[model samples]
Target: MNWILLIIAGLFEVGFATCLGKAKENSGNNAIMWYLGFLFCLTISMVLLVKVSKELPIGTAYAVWTGIGAVGSVVVGIFVFKEPATFWRVFFLSTLILSIVGLKFVSK
Candidate 1:
């Protein structure tokens, strides 16, 4: 389904973003490696975005895709990267999730 592809694409968005953070921690060849990984995942994300765009409304698809990426990246940041888990941050993330779900239900 297009929605499924959209979800996968969003996940890859999170993947590339995480790679970007990792790249920032390194230098020289190591950083280049991470950057390359980021680019690869980013390409996949964009490809899927374009694929789903043919079926779904671009505005809805893009908003959901980015919502997924934003929430996923924040979760990875808190858990994998040990970023702060402030209450307000979690609260806002919940709202974002709700909005994504609402979009899905309302989508034709």
Candidate 2:
């Protein structure tokens, strides 16, 4: 359950990052809306992180959290934002995915 919350929290971290990107790409009311989304997602992500950290080891949880966010944001950057998906970029992301999975297995 805690792990699930942590994953959700990590996803919200992606949400905030996406919102920031969208905000940067817009202006006027549209930018304001994206900024509001960023704040909302950031709040929820932090709350869930705090809740899950109580049950999980802090170091493991934090690493996993950031790992998920990094991986997700990169994927979003490639897909949604049309960022380049170079070979080395994908290779590193694969490693990051493996490490996140490994952490889940090694933890708790």
Best model number under lDDT: 2
For candidate 2, the clash count comes to 0
Off by over 4 Å in 1: none
Ten contiguous residues minimizing lDDT sum, candidate 1: 17-26
lDDT of 1 by residue, 6-85 (tens): 99999999999999999998999999999999999999999999999999999999999999999999999999889999
lDDT of each: 0.97, 0.98
RMSD of each: 0.7, 0.4
Residue 15 error for model 2, in Å? 0.2
lDDT of 1: 0.97
**Model 2 Cα displacement at 30 (Å)?**
0.3
lDDT of 2 by residue, 1-108 (tens): 999999999999999999999999999999999999999999999999999999999999999999999999999999999999999999999999999999999998
TM-score of each: 0.97, 0.99
Residue 91's lDDT within candidate 2 is 100
- The parts of candidate 2 lying over 4 Å away from their true place are none
Q: Can you give the lDDT of residue 66 in candidate 2? A: 97
